[model samples]
Every structure is written in C-alpha cells, then in structure tokens.
Target chain A: MAATMNDVAQRAGVSVKTVSNVVNGYPHIRETTRARVLAAIEELDYQLNVAARNLRTGRTGIIALAVPELSLPYFAELADSVIQAADAQGLTVLIEQTGSRRERELEVLSGARRHLTDGLLFSPLALGDGDEQLLDVDFPMVLLGERLFPDTVDHVTMQNVEGARAATEHLLGLGRRRVAVVGVHPGEVVGSAGLRLTGYRQALEAAGVPWDESLLGEAGLWHRSTGASAMAHLLDSGAAPDAVFAMNDAMALGVLHELQVRGIRVPDDVAVIGFDAVDEGEYSNPSLTTVDPGREQIAETAVRLLVEQIADKRGTHRPRRVYADFRILERRSTLPA
Target chain B: MAATMNDVAQRAGVSVKTVSNVVNGYPHIRETTRARVLAAIEELDYQLNVAARNLRTGRTGIIALAVPELSLPYFAELADSVIQAADAQGLTVLIEQTGSRRERELEVLSGARRHLTDGLLFSPLALGDGDEQLLDVDFPMVLLGERLFPDTVDHVTMQNVEGARAATEHLLGLGRRRVAVVGVHPGEVVGSAGLRLTGYRQALEAAGVPWDESLLGEAGLWHRSTGASAMAHLLDSGAAPDAVFAMNDAMALGVLHELQVRGIRVPDDVAVIGFDAVDEGEYSNPSLTTVDPGREQIAETAVRLLVEQIADKRGTHRPRRVYADFRILERRSTLPA
Candidate 1:
C-alpha cells in the first residue's frame, strides 16, 4: 500500500494534524516540526492524495479545455500549446471536444467532474452575447475567444480586427483591389470571422475601395474544402477579385489549390493571404502569407492567469482582458517578394 | 447553491438514508424507492459530487493516457482516437505528456491522481524491461505497445511483426532485393522497432536474400528529420538500396523528401513503404504505402476492456493480448498496381 499521512506522522514522531498543517503550508508549524514532517514525507515519497484532499480543499490539479474541434489544425495547435503551458505549471488538462455545441459547453461547465478541476479554459463557438450567465459561474474560469463579450470574466483574445486589417492592408498595399473574404459568419459581427470581415471592410474603406457585398463568401465552417468552394463561387461569378483573404490558413490553402487547378497564377491573377499561422501553411505548395495570432503567447498567458485565479479567493483578483499581438507573416502567396 | 441530498430526500418523501441507499444503487432497495430517488435527481439535475463518491466507491471515471509526446502527430492522433473511444463509454481522459522520460511516466503512475483514474493507458518509450515494477502497481491498467511483455497485465498491441513482414514482403514482391530499414533502434528487441526489425529479418530469410546490416539506418527519433537523415546515410554509403521501409509515416515522409531532393522518382526509382498509417501519409506528394496498425480498433478494444473491468469485479477475466489486424495500404509511392 502507498504510504499514508498516519505512516508519515508516526515515522516523524508527530501528529496527523501537524503533518497536515505542514503539507498545507499552514503558518503555525514550527520550523523543526516542518522539517521533520518534510523529511518523513520525502523518505516515504509520499504523494498527497489529491482525491482525499479535494474533499476538504475542493481543488484538483486538473483543468478543462473546451475547444471547437481538434480535427481543425488551428484548434489542435492551440490545444497543444495550451497543454504544453499547463505541463510547465505541473497541471493536467481534460480536453473536451465541444464539436461547436452550445448545450455541450453548458453541460461541461456543470458536470460533476467540475470538482475534479481547479478551473476551465473555455473557447466557445456557439455561445454568444446573450450567454452572460456563463460568466456568473462560481468556479474559476478563463474565457478564450471573440464570440462572447461578458465584462465580468477574464478573457484572452487576439487582435482579430487588427490582424485581419493587416492581412487586407498587405493585399491592398500590393496594389490588389476587389479582394474577396472567405469563411464569413453570417449576420454576426463579433466572432472571429465577423471581426475579420469588419477589418476587411475597414481596410477597403481606408483604401478608397468599395466593399462589395458580392465579394463576401459565406462559409459556416472555416475548412479547406469550404475555402475551395467559396473561391470557386467567387471565380464563377466572373467578379474576379484582385486578391483573396481567407479567414484561416486551411481555407487559404484550399483557395490556393483551386487556383492551381484552374490555371490561375497566384500573385499574378490573384494574391492570397490567410490568418492563424498554422504549421501546414509553412509547407503548402507555394507557402502561404498569413497573420500570426500569437497563439503560443496567448496559451501561456491564459494558463498563468487561470492558475493565479485558481490559487486565490473568488473576489481576491480583478478580472482582466489580455489581448495578444498579431503580426503579418509575409510568405510566398501574397506578392512576388 | 446546488440542491442538497436533504432537498432531494424531502422532494422524494423518503428518509435521507433511504435516499442515499437508492442513490448509491443499493441492491436491497425497492424498485419504487429507486424510481423516486432517480426522479428527484433528474428533477433537480443533481449531479453527484464525484469527489465524495470516489471516496465511497473508490472508482473515478477518469483515465490517464500517458504518451511519449504530443508534438508528434502520431501521438496526437493516438490521443484523439483514445479520447473518442473513452467518451463513447462515458469516461473522461486526463492526458499526460511524458516526453519519453521513464521517471515522468512512473511518477504519473504513482502520483496522487492514480486515485483519480479508473485505470491508466501507459505508452512508455524509455521504460524497457528493467522497469517491470510498473506492472506491480496496485490498480487496474491496460498497457499499449510492445515495450512490455509482463504476463500479469493485459496488453493491447498491433501486428508490428506481421505488418513489417508484409511491408518488406510487398517490397520484395516488387522485385526489389536491396531493402533498407530506417529508424533502427539500439540494443532493443522488444519495442515496435525491434519487433518490426525481427519481421524484416524474417522476410529476408524467407526470400533467400542475405540480410545486410550495412543497409541499416539508425534514427534515434521516429520523425521526418530522422528519416531524411537516415536515407541520406544510406545514399552516402555507396550501396543504393532498391527500396526503403521506414518504421513509421513521419520517417517515411522524410525519406520521400530526400528522394525528391535527389531527383529520384518514388516507386519508379525506389519503392517506399511506411508503418502506422498517419493521416499525412495519404496526402504526401506520391502518397505513401504504409501499414494500418488498426489504431482505432486498438483504442476501442482497450477502452472496452477497461470499462468492463471497472463495471464488473468478476475481475477473473483472462488477461488478453490483442494484436490488431494490419493491412498494406497501396499508394503511389509503392510498386504500380
């Protein structure tokens, strides 16, 4: 059997309460007593039974990551980065594949396993502005995304507007007008795609280029196949955009594939740019010019913030919004340079 | 606040002890009492506190998937498959990245979370025959991979030997006598590579072809870079192998890249085959001929066995050594169909 607190206490010539106090970092334990308990614990290689301790302290060194889907490389990459960050902090992640379900998100939040995790890092796809009640959850949580804008909870977001703006500006600076936006969320104006759409419009307005509704290609799923189909639609309309801005790298890759298939020269007939610098973007046929959303940094920051909040009382820390930087990662698909 | 057991008991018009007995699924409880307790639970949406339940029943529906690394696509895919299988059975996974460190793997097994999981699915890379004590852990676990052969534990493995034999046989059937093996591990005769290496040797012996150690390429890592370097080493040795069999797809991709760099046509110049049908293999330039080790089947089988063992203590179930079927996926990189 594994060594127990009673065993350690007996070995150290101390009471079980004294050993518990030392383990919990209580202030009253004498230095000698603490040392004796520590030595006994070390000698036995005692691992505090988190299951038992969680009953009293109500904390498990586990966290949940609710993401849209892992089949998509972007979310997969983000999950990887987040897991790495969590590993560095000596925590484990319970990944929940939401499959873009709002009900599932709520279910996961209220599951009995919530007691098994210190906090949750939720990335919502279906939950929107009206779901502010999620912020009122008593457990420690860090929100991640552009979909929901509750003011009471901590959120880690990227500069989607600015990043999309830079992507569009990059295409326009190359003297390409009539740019088509791929993977748009219909009607919504705050999600990742919606914000990028706004940034696209802003860029066109700044460049004295009219934002044509015809140039917007609606894609419910930001996948490579969708990007390809959207590009096919845009090309079939004969309203040839001088460039294309795919909201994500997967879609951008699809667009590139479609262009290559139809004998259309990239950067000659149409320049292309994408967002969320995926690793696959670096290995595409001609490579892809995209925006780096600072995924790695955001992951690390979110973990650090959630860990801090988890280690404190509910009202002890003020909720703060952290916005990571976005940069234009210029590659082969945009201009000749 | 969440509804309490007292509230549930009052709502069901039963004693709290009776309610507890019903909630805990006491075999002696009447059907009417059980129905009322369940109805009350549903009405209140009262999810049981798993932490408390764990202390009473000593079973947590969580399992740990201790993998070598997630940065590798293979591990990531394996994790995804494992989670899917586990979720279907109403279980959650707590992922731990061991980075192939034996200490980390053993630490995770012996950690406090051992009480938090129903069992463990351990994939050890560094822990060899010497770490046999792991099989002695006082908990239920299903081992994955060929790193261990302890008769005391249940092991779910792929047809590495037979699959490698088939792959080498496929290359030889293509009239290629000189087949080089990439990612040859050192002093190992029990892991995947070791088993596959044995298969390769068996195939050579059966074919009346001499086994040449000179064609062996050492790759410490089963990654693309390692594959590429190993292929280069083969080329630099002045003996040009007619075919190459990479132990895994990542290494196979690297070999393909090296061939491309050297203007050597795949299949035409040298037939290439890989093991572990990673998704990327299907999309490679010439595509890739690899062995499908039935990863999905392996995952599902392991999960079913674990959940069965958890639900029933007739625990006298025989320890199973399941070797999944392997198939040679014919792609353009191999001999013409």
Candidate 2:
C-alpha cells in the first residue's frame, strides 16, 4: 500500500495536522519538526497523492496544451519548448490533439475535462473569429496562434504578417521578379495563411511588382504532399516565377524537392524562402532560408502568462495580448553565399 | 452554475438515476424517455463532469504518454500517431516529457501525477534493463522503444535489427564495400542503437566486408547537431567510407548536411541511409532512404493493448511482447536511379 499522511505522522511521532503543515510548507513549523517530518516522509518514500490534493485545493498542477497536431514540425517544436518551460515551473503538461477540427475544438472548450487541468494553453487552428465568445470560460486559458479574439483572454501570438513580409522582401531583394507563393488558403482572411498572403502582397507592392493571380498556389492543408502538388500545379501552368515563398518550412521543403525533381536549381533558377525555422530546414538540401518566429520566446511567454493567471486568485487581471519577435534566417536556399 | 444530474432529471420530469442511466447510454431505457432526457440535457447544455466521475470511479479517460522528448522528430511523429490512434478509441492523451534523463524517467514511474492518468504509455530512453523492477507498478502501462524487461509488462517494439540489416544490405547491393555508421551509443548492448549496430555488423559479415572500428561514429544524443559533429569527426579523422547509415533520420539529415557542406555529392560519393522514415525524409534534398518501422501500427497496437489493460477488471492477462514490421523505403539517398 502507498504511504499516507497518517503513516508519516506515526513514523515521526507527531500529529497528522503537524505533518500536513510541514508538507504544505507552513511557516509556523519549527525547523526540527520539519526535518523530522521530512525524514519520516523520505523513509516511507511517500508521494503525496496529487489527485486527492487537487480535490482539496482545486489545483491539479497540470496544464493542458491543445494543438492542431504534433505531426507538424512547428507545433511539435512549440510543444517541446512549452514542456520545457513548464518543467522549469514544476508543472506537467497534458497534450490534446484537436486535429484542427471545429467540432473537436469546440468539444475541448466545453468538455468537463477542463476541471482536470489547472489551466489550458490553446492553439486553435480551426476555431476562428466567429468563436470569440467561447473564450469567456471560467477557467484560466491563454490563446496561441494568429486567431485574434476579443481581449477577454490572454493571447500569445507570432508576428505572422511581419515575418512573412521579411521573407518575401528577402526574396524580392534577390532581384527576382514574378515571385510565387505556395500554401495560400483560398478565401482565408484572418488565419496565418491570410495574414502571410497580405504580407507577401505588401512586399511585392513595395518592390514595384504587381500581384499576379496566376502566381498564387492554392493549398488547403499545408502538408508536404499538398505543397508538392501545389508546386507541381504552378510548374504545369507555365507561369514561371523567379522566386517562391512557401508559408512554412514543410511546404518550402516540398517546393525544393519538386524543383529538384524538375531539374530546377534553387536560388539559381528560383530563389525560395519559408517561415518557421524548424530544425528540418537547417538540413534540407541547400538548406532553407526561413523566418524564425521566436518560437521559444513564445512558448516561454505563454507558459509564464498562463502560470500567472492560474495563480491569480483575485481574477481581477485583464486579458493581455503578447507577440513574439521574428527574424529572417538566411541560408543557401535564398543566397548562394 | 453548471447543471447537475438533479437539474437534468427535474427538467426531463424523470428520476436522477434514470437520467444518469440515459446519459450513460443504458440500452434498457425506452425511446421516449431517452429522447426526453437527451432533450433536457441539450436544453441545459449539460456536460458530464469527468473530474467528479474520476473521483468516484478512479478513471479519467486520459492516458499518459511519457516520451524522452518531443523535439526529436521520431518521438514527435510517434506521439502524433499515438494521439491519433487514441482519439479513434475515444481516449485523450496526456504527454509528459522526461527529457531523456534517468532520474526523470524514474520520477515518472513513481510520480504522484500517475494517479491522474488511467494508464501510461512509456517510451523510455534513459532507463535501461537494470530498472526492470520499477515496471511492477499497479497501473497499466505499455512499454515503447527498446529496454526490454523480463515480461513484467506489455511492450511494443520495432524490428530494429532486421530493418538495419536491410538498409546495410541495400547499400552493400550498391557495391559499397565500406559503410560507415553514425549514432552508435557507447557500450550499448540491447538498446535500439546496439541492435542496429549488430544488424550493421551482420550485414557486413554477410557481404564479406570487414568491420572497421574507425568507421563507427559515437553519438551521445541521436540529434542532428550530434550527427553532424560525429560525421565531421569521422571525416576529420580520415575514416573514409563509400556509404553511411545513420541510426535515425535526424542524424542522417545531419550527415547529409555535413557532406553537402564538405562538397561531397550524395549517392555518387557516399550513399546515405537512415532508420525511422520520418516525414522530413520524404522532402529532404536527394530525399532519404529509410526503414519504415510500422510506426502507426505500433501506436495503434500499443493503444489497443493499453485500453484493454485499462478495462481489464479481471487482471488475468499476461505480459506480451509485440514487434512491428519494418520495410526499407527506397528513396534517392541510397540509389541514384
């Protein structure tokens, strides 16, 4: 049987309340008593039952992180960083995959599982501006990604537009006209794709290059296969682009692969750049030039904000929006040197 | 205030027990009564309190997945597959990062937080065979990766040896006599690295090639940076090999990057192969030839076994060791054609 508070108390020849006070770090306990209780607890190898303690304090010391998918390198890296940051705070993370489905995301918001976690770190890919009212939950939550809701909940977001603009400008500065973009979600106006598209257009306009509809490659899901197919379609249409900007590194990788398969040399024939400085980009053939969206900073800030919110018993703090910085990581894909 | 069973019962004009039975999908309820109860539930937007239910029944419908790290592409993809497979069975996964530390891995085994999870899907990188006694925990757990125990718990493993042998033979078939290996863990005997090294040696013997000690590159961590460093060390030490096999895809990618940096042409100068057919391999420049260790299958089977163990009221099942099949994916890295 697992050791109990009573067992520790008996071992220490003290009252259960005294042992509890010691365990809870009560300041009133004498150093000698605390040491005795600790030694007893150590001898028994007692682990305080977190679930049972949660019932009393209403805090499980667990934070739920809901992401679209871990298969995506971006989210995977983000998760890794979050877990690391949370570990520093002595908290464990519980991951939930919503599969970027509206129904599933909604379920996560309304589900009773919310009580099992101290707070939630939600990165909603499917929930849009229309679902803003759902953010008004009783529990603590910090929103992630580009979906900007009303300032009713804390949000940690990447500088999507700024990052994309930098990437597009890098390609345009390479003296390449007719720049094409892959992973343009059709009719998207508020998500990462839409924001990046706006940035791309802004860069093109600044470079005195007119936006061409023929240069846009439509992609619903930003998977490698989708990126490959989109690149193939762009090539088949005979609308040659001197430069290409894939929204993310995965798609950028696909574009590079497709170009290689078609005997088109990167940077020489078509300069390419991408967003999300995933580790995979560093080793891709020719390497990838990408916008590093300060993923570690974002993860750290989100965890810090969420932990603060969880500890705020008064619940009087207003929601705040924070954004991470971005920088272009130049590599061989965009520049030969 | 959230609606309770009593509120639902009163709204449906039925008893609380009947309402609970209806909510629990009791088949004996009449169609009219079920409809009325469901309507009441809908009207109240009632959600089942999983925490309250867990307190009563000690089941949270949440399984914990303890992996070494999510930053590694292999573990991230494996986690993705496990989450997908669990979702299909209506189970949610909680991820715990052990950071590949032995103390952390042991802490996970004895942690109080384990009570919050129905079972654990543990993928240990730090804990070795000597820690087998720790597997005697009361909770249901399915072991993943190597580090086999004495049949104390269910284990899901990949065919590391066979897969490595096939990869080596593929390079040998290309008439490459000297094949260098990357990501060899020092003093490993039964782990994935050790098993793969054994397979490499077996293939060398089968092909009548001599094993050179200098050809082995030691890597403490099977990460891309480590892979690059190991490859660089090999190159600087003048250990020239016609082909290279990295223990995992991340390391292979690093090797490829290093070779490119050194102006060495892949598949022409030194053929490269990797284990673990991660998605990154598919889009890598020259692409990557790798062993597909049936990751999805392993995940599905692990989840199935875990779920079964969770529901095993009799607790009569014996520990089973299951291996997933492996197939060599012929990509551009191994063969130019």
Candidate 3:
C-alpha cells in the first residue's frame, strides 16, 4: 500500500497539516522541519496526493489553450507552438475546440474545467460585440490573436492589418492590377478577417488602384472548400483578376487548386499570396508566399504573461498587451515571371 | 465569503463528512440526507471545491490524449476526433505532444500529470522494442495506434496492413504495372510503415507482378517535405513508374506537387493513390484517392475503453484490443484516363 500523508506526518513527528504544507511547497516551514519531513517521506516512500496539494495551494500546474479547431492548419500549428511554449514552462495543456461557435465559446469561459487548470490561453473567433463582459473572468487568462476583451486581461496578438497591407502592397508592386481579395466577413470591423480586409483596402488606396467590388470574394468559414467556391464564383461571374490575396494559407491553397483546375498558370495568368506562413504553404505546388505573424513569439509571450498572472496570487500584476512582429515571406507563388 | 462544507453541514444538521459525501456524489448516501445537503448547498449557493472533492473521490473528470504532433494533419484530425468523443462522455481532454521522441514518450508514462487526469489515450510513435515495460503504469490507460505494449493494457488501432493492401491493389487494378510505393522503412516488419509495406508486397504477390527494387521510395518522417524529396529522388534516378502509392496523404500531396512542378500530367502519365483520407486530400490538385482508416471509430472506441477503465475502480475490466475498419476512397487522383 502507498504511504499517505498521515503516515508521513507520524513518521516525521509533525501534524498532518504541517506535512501538507511542506509537501505543497509552502515558504513558511523551517529548513530543519522541511528536511525532516522530506527524509521521512523518502524513507516511507510517500506518494504525495496531488489533489490534496492542489486543494491547499490552488495550483494545478496545468493550463488550457482554447482555439477554434485543430483541423485548420493554422490553428494546428498555433496549438503546436503553444504546447511547446507551455512545456518549456513545465505546464500541461488542455485543448478545447470552440468550432468558432458562440455557444461553445461561452461554454469554454464558464466551463467546469476552469477549476481544473491554472490559466487559459484563449484565441476566440466568434465572441465579439455584445460578448465583451464574458472576458471579465476571474481566472488567470491571456487572450491570443486579437484584443477583443476588456483592458483588465492580458493579451498577445499579431499585426493582422499591417501584415495584410504588406501582402497587398507586394502584389501591387509586382505591376498587377485588379488585386482580388479572398475571405471578407461582410460587415465585420474587428477580428482577423476584418482587420486584414482593412489592410488590403489601405494598400489599394495608397497605390491609387480602384477598389473593384467584383474582386472581393466573400468566404464565411475561411476554409479551403469555401475559398475554392469563392474563386469559382468570381471567375464564373466573368470577373477577371490578375492577382489574389487569400486571407489565410488554407484558403490560398484552395484558391491555387481552383486556378490549376481551370488550366490557369500561377505567376503568369494570375499571382497568389496568402496569410499565416503555415508549413503546408512551403510545400504547395508553386509554394505559397505568406505573412509570418511571429507565431512563436506570440505563443511564448502569451504563456509568459499567463504564467505571470498565475504566479500573482494577490492579483497585483497589471495586465499587459503585446503585439508580435510580422513580415512577408516571399515564395514562388508571387515571384516575377 | 463563500460557504464551506462545514456551513452546509451545520445548516443540514449533519457532519461535515456527510456534506462532502453528498457533494462528491457518493452512491451510498441516503436520499433524505443527500436531499438535505443539496438543499443547504443551494440555499447558501456553495460552490463545491472540485479539488477537495477530487481528493476524496480520486477522479478528475479529465482524460489526456497524447499524440506525436499536431503539425501532422493525421494526428491533428485524430486529436479533434478524440476531443469530440471524450466530450460526448462529459470528459475534458488534455493534449500532450510527445514529438515521437523516446524520452518524451517515456516521460508521458511517468509524468506528474498522471494523477491530475483520470486516464490517458496514448499513441506512441517512438516507443518500439525494449520499451514495453514503461506501459505498466499504475493508472488507467488506453493505447492508440498499433499495439506495442503488453496484453494487460487496452488498445485501439487502425487497419494499417489491410488498408495498405487495398491501396496497392487499386493501383494494380488500374492496369499500371509499375506501381511504385513511397514512404518505406527498410527492414521494418511492424508499426504503420512496416505493416503497410507488407500489405504492398502481398498485393503485388497476389497480382503476380514482379517486385521491382528500384520502384521503392524511402522516406523517414512521412512528412510533405520528405515526401516531395523522396519523389524527386525516385524520378531523378530514372525509375519510370506508371503509378505511385504513397503510404499516407501528406506524402501523396507532396508527390502530386512534385509531379506538377515537373510539368508531368497526373493520371495521364502516372496515376497516384495515397492512404489516410485527410480533408486536405479532398482539396489537393486532382484531389486524392486514399484509404479511410475509420479514425472516428478509433477515437470513440479508445475513449469508451479508457472511461470504462477509469470507472472500474476495482480494476475488474479485462484489457481488450479493438481494430477500426478501413476502406478505399476513390477520388480524382486515381481516375482512369
């Protein structure tokens, strides 16, 4: 039978609560008493009850990372980065998929698992406008992707608008007019899609290029199939585009496939660029050029801020907002002929 | 201040232990006593301390799903399936990436997080030969992928060998005599790569086709970059093949991309087929004909098995091995000209 706290306490000639305090790494215990307790625990082979320690210290050494879904390559890669970053901090990650749904995101915020993890690194896609109050959670949390929450929460985000502007400017500098854009969320003025769209418009405005409404492809899900259908719709409507800027790599890959099926040559008949420098983009047919949104830095910074919050037991640490750097990764898709 | 167990107990005219029992959902508590405790808790709006309840009941209501890496589309999709399946059982899933490294895989078995989660759904990519003893962990665990552990542990695996045989046979049925196989691990006889190789050989034997040594393409990591390089090596070596059977879809997509870059027409020159019906396969150029390894069934079955072990406090449940079904999904990549 495994030795319990009572056995360790009896062996160490101390009270059970004293033994628990020592096991939970309480700072008030004397060095000699701690050494005695540790010797007793080693002698009796006492396996500390993690639940009991967590109950006393309120530290689970685990964190939750909530994303839309893992099936999307960008999210999968982001999850990969977050997991690695959390691992470096000696933290375990619990992943929750919101499926980009409003109800699921709400459930994540108020879920029973809140007590199971020490903090959460949330990247919400659907919670916006009226859902600001939901971010007023008492638990230690750090938001990722964009700052859509109250100022009291720490956040780590990317320069979505600037990245999109650079992508559009790259296409415009290549002497291509009629720069089409994929993935517009209609009236959304926040979030990734909206900010990236604004960036595209800014680039077009700076270049004195007319904003052709026909070139704007509307894709709700930003999925590959949707991107393909959106491209097909634009082409079937007799809209000729010399270049396209997909909002993400997944959608860009789909757009590339659609153009290939229609017997159009990339970088000749049409140039393409995508956002989110996902690994899949590096191996795509012509390879994809995309925006490097400093994902690793975002993940590391988010975990660091969340750890800081978790460690601030008295709620003394002020919330911080950080934006990771961004750059354009030029590749074959947008290269000169 | 929030109400504690003592407050609830005093209000219900019972011992603090009785309130703890009721809150932990102990089965032996009398209906009247349970109702009184519940009423007191509701009247005081007491939030049950999950940690305290967990210490008493020894259940965390969270299971861990450990895989190699989410950057791989197969594992990402598998994690998604496992999360959904675990959610159906009202269980939270914690994801751990092992990176297919031996030390990390071993660490997962003996990690401190073992006590924090109810059980583990482990898919080890690195623990081969001489590492079987690590699976003898005290906690409840359900193994995924091929069985590499003792018979004392429950296992849920896919039909690797049979699926590969079907994939190879499909290419043979297309009148392609030189059906090259990609992603081969030399001298391997077990695991996914080895089993799939055996199936390929079996298909070739049944078809009475001569085994061409030059037609085998070797790839170590089964990644897109490696797949593309393997295809380039095979093509550069002057091994003219009429058809190619990639071991997985990621590599298959790479092969298609490489062919496209070389201006070689797919299906017109060399038909290609892949295994693992990932969603990306549906959007790749010419799409992809691959094997669907019943990933959802594997995930659901694994979670069910793990939950059973977790619920069986007496350890009375015998370990069982389950194999998910597989089938060939025909797509545009393997269409007849």
Prediction 1 global C-alpha lDDT: 0.83
lDDT of 2 at B290: 93
Clashing pairs in 2: none
Window of ten residues with lowest summed lDDT in model 3 chain B: B145-154
- The local distance difference test score of each candidate is 0.83, 0.89, 0.89
List runs of model 3 lying over 4 Å from the truth. Answer: A5-46, B1-46, B147-150
Clashes per model (N, Cα, C within 3 A): 0, 0, 0
* Stronger candidate by DockQ (1 vs 2): 2
Cα lDDT tens digits for candidate 1, B1-80: 56768888999999878878877678998888889888998999776667776766777789988888765667777878
- Which segments of model 2 are wrong by more than 4 Å? A6-17, A30-36, A313-315, B9-19, B26-37, B313-316
**DockQ, 0 to 1 scale, candidate 1:** 0.40
Tens digits of per-residue lDDT, candidate 2, A1-337, equal 6688999999999998999899988899888999999999999988776666776777888898999889899999999999999989988888888889988888778755766788999998887767788878888899987776788899999998888888999988888888999999888888999999999999988888998999999888888888888999999999898889999888988999999889898889998898889988888888899999999999999999999999997899899999999999999999852
* Cα deviation of A133, candidate 2, in Å: 2.7
Ranking by DockQ: 3, 2, 1
Put down candidate 3 lDDT per residue, B1-337, tens digits, no spaces: 5578999999999999898888768899989999999999989877767787788778888898899999999999999999999999989899999898878888888755766889999998888666677887888999998635568789998888888899999999999899999999897766788899889999999999999999999998889977888899999999998899999999998998899789888888989999878988887878889999999999999999998998898888898999999999999889988
lDDT of 3 by residue, A171-262 (tens): 99999998999998888887788899999999999999998999999999889999999899889987899999999989998999899889
